[model samples]
Target: MWQIFSRFLALGLISFGGPAAHIGYFRKAFVDDLQWLDSKQYASFVALSQFMPGPGSSQVGFAIGYHKGGVLGGLAAFLGFTLPSFLLLFLFAVTSAQWLEISAVQGIIHGLKLLAVVVVADATLSMFTQFCQRKTAKMLMATTAVAIILMPSMLMQIAVLVMAAIIGGILLTRGENITPENPPITLNYSWLALFILCLASSLYFIGQDDTIGQIFAQFFQVGSLVFGGGHVVLPLLEASVGDYITPDRFLTGYALAQAIPGPMFTLATFLGADLWLESPILGAIVATIAIFLPGFLLMLVGLKSWHTISQRPHIAGVLAGVNAAVVGLLFAALYQPVFTSAVIMPLDMALVIIGFSLLKVFKPGIVWLVMGFAATGALLTLI
Candidate 1:
């Protein structure tokens, strides 16, 4: 437990670049350094995380913790891995926006965005290689990407994923579908009930205006409904919460989240604190907790039966299709706000290319990349 705490805490502080990069960080830490889990086990955890509807990388981390020390270990891992982002978001919430105006801070954010491009590009390639080995799968990946780009929205994302699943079921069921080993076979009725209750309660309470209840309900709904990656939640949250928080602050939080480690879902912490300035800490805690609770609940409930479900050929095909759609989702996100928003200049694109080369060839850990890029950006801004 202590080892998990220390290692994940380290990850939380320096693991920027969002879910994809965070997964790479986790693989390096757990699979390579600690040897806590083998590659296959970690891959299985990632597969389950991606298949579920929660925060992608965070769920993977939670599953790893659950495997390590049962529920308590899972909690420890969540707290440890998430603590840094919690602190950073809380600070961003309380601090003046002028702080972001500082040259160094802007530099840090610029560098981080460049880092995000590299990390996400790597993840897209890696997932394609692993999941889209077949020609049909590859074609589906391209088709999904084109569809999302042509008609991008929250509804479109969900629709594309569903269509991808149907296509997967129809097209991918030809081969043997072996169940992944070490399946979580136990069912907790109370857990599922609680998940349903929380979801229902949040929906029930979404209409309360100018109240914490409304905030909680909105964030909770975003958590419950958004699929694929953390970035996918942007449009949903933007549509739902835009009425309360100004677009600038919201975009700022989003960009800042890209720079920080841990789950991008922690953007809830900043939003909560900013919205309820009278009691910022309470706001931060409630908002953060509300947004993530649904995912954790669903994961805890679903992990118990996912592998058994995966054993069916049709279901496996669906998962395969869903996986392809996920890559498409990430690919679409990388283009819209991520690439479009960040890489505005040739220098920015050049920085990203250099970062990618470093990542592929030198293979430095994320901490160094964050620092090096931050410094480079800061120096350039000063110059």
Candidate 2:
């Protein structure tokens, strides 16, 4: 359990490229390296996490923990996987003003937006290969992509996901048997009680005027309420910080978050720093905790009943639909944040094409691509 926790903690600190990249990291570390679970089991866990609310990576971590040490193990896994980014973000939040204002930082941020395009594209393709095997799933993917391109709204995307689940549940219910391959596992209620106690303590601390309290509350709320994964948190976070921070600064931190190699929620660090300019450290801590709270809570709730839930025929169909919808959401994000912000000139367009091609054709390591792009962007900025 300690070993698993340590591994996830290290990955959490360094794993970047959003949820998709995080998934890759989890697969490499836990699936390929550890041989902890088979490919099918890993895929099933991925599917289950996507179907449930909160960050997909966090849930994956929770699943790993559960596999290792039961419910307590799950909590340790969640903490290990999430703490690094949270700490880094908290640090960044404390020093945001100076860190964000650097010209080199601006250039790198611009480059990172382009990287997002490649990451999202690669993720979409990978998911398609893994999940979009059936005709119904293919149709759903195509239809959702079109809807997102034609009418772009987060709400609409969510509605489509819900509708797809309903349709899929109706259609895919025939001749389906729901059974768990693995025997049902027992949960430690004492661990659950401890989790509740921590949550209560977190809530109480949130009301205090100290920097720690403010951050605790804010991040806890973000983590608890956010339903979808990292991408879905954007609008909610945008709303949360809008009253407190400026658009330009927010965009800057957002761009930096893209450039970094970890969870997107690390943007909380940037936001936290911006919010408490005089105390950037406090900001980073707040941001880190706020973004992760939801994933932790959801994982606990989901793990408690994952065996029963996984065995439902309708649940599989709904997950299939949700995965398709996730692809659509990624497509929309590519257009809005990646294309709209970064792909302006012909040179930028060329880079995007090349980046997409590199990902699709060579299937290069994401970390390498990000580094290569960051270097190329730096050179371009100088030129």
Candidate 3:
């Protein structure tokens, strides 16, 4: 369990390209490499996480850990995956104001933004191939894509998910059975106790306006309410921190969050650093803890019920629909943040096209692409 946690933690430190990409990384490591769970189980968990909310990739990580070693396993996975981003955000929240002023940092970020587009595009294609195998699933994918592109509103996205659930339920009236060839793993009481302890501590510490207290309260709320992944957290975080931090600073931190590795929730790092610089270290700590609290709680609740939930045909259908919609959401994200924000010139457009080609055609590792682009961007900035 500790070994698994250590591996996931290392992956979290270096993993970039958002939730979709994180899924790819997990598939490669856990499914393809580790053989921890079969493809079907993985698909089910991914679908379940997508349906329930609170950062899909993070939930996936927890599920992987849980499957491997029960509740303690889940905690290890969450900690391993989250720690890097937490540490990075802490440093950034402390130093971003100074570091971001550098032209090189700005240039590197600009280039990395284009890479984000390529990474997400690749992930969308991969997910569609994996999950949208059935004709009904394919239709859901197309419909959701059109709706998201046409509407592009938050409420509309939720409505699309709800409607998809209804449609999926109608289609999946006949049940599909998932037989576990191996015996089911038993839950560990110790892990459950620890999880409960964390929850209790968070609740106890979350008091009115104190730095740590506010962190606990705010993150707990976000974790509890956020349905989508990191992107969904953006507007919410902006609203929460905007009162204390400038819009420009917020935007800059957001941009930096995009460039770094790990979960997009690492945006908490920016919030923490901004608060820390603007106020105190206590503020930074509070902000960091607050942002991740919801996700942890959601994971705990979901794991308790996943066995029963995974069995229902209607639930499966909705997950199928949601997974398809996730593809569309990834597409929309590629268009907005990655393409719109970074690709300003003809050369920039060419670079993006090339990056997409490399990913789609060659399928080189993401790290290589990132490194190549970072160097290209640095050179471009000099020119």
Q: Which candidate leads in TM-score?
A: 1
Better of 1 and 3 by lDDT: 1
lDDT of 1: 0.78
lDDT of 3 by residue, 1-383 (tens): 87978989889987877787799999999999989999988887786676665778988888899889987898799889988877776776676558777888777767776675666567667777976787877787788778766766656666766776787777743565553343343454554575567666666765555455656555655554455576656544644555667755565566566667788877776676555545646665566656665565555665655666666666677767766666666666556544666678899889888988987788776568878777787788798
lDDT of 2 by residue, 1-383 (tens): 78878988789767866787788889998899989888877886776677666677777877877877887888788778767766665555555557656766666766777776666566667777766777777777778767866876545655677777776676645455767364565564654575567567667876565466666666666565444476655544654555577655565566666665666766777777776666777666666666666566555665656657767777777777666656655566556544676777898788888988987788777678768887887777677
lDDT of 3: 0.70
lDDT of 1 by residue, 1-383 (tens): 88777778988887766688889999998899888889988887787777777788888888888888888888788889899999988987788566888888887777766776777677677777888888778888888788877887557766877888999999988676475364556766777898888888887788777788877887887787666657766656765677788765676677667666789888889888987878999889888888777777777876767767657778778878887877777677678656776787899999999998998899887667767777887887887
Candidate order by lDDT, highest to lowest?
Answer: 1, 3, 2
lDDT of each: 0.78, 0.68, 0.70
Error in Å for residue 341 of model 1: 1.8
RMSD to the true structure for each prediction, in A, is 3.8, 4.8, 5.5
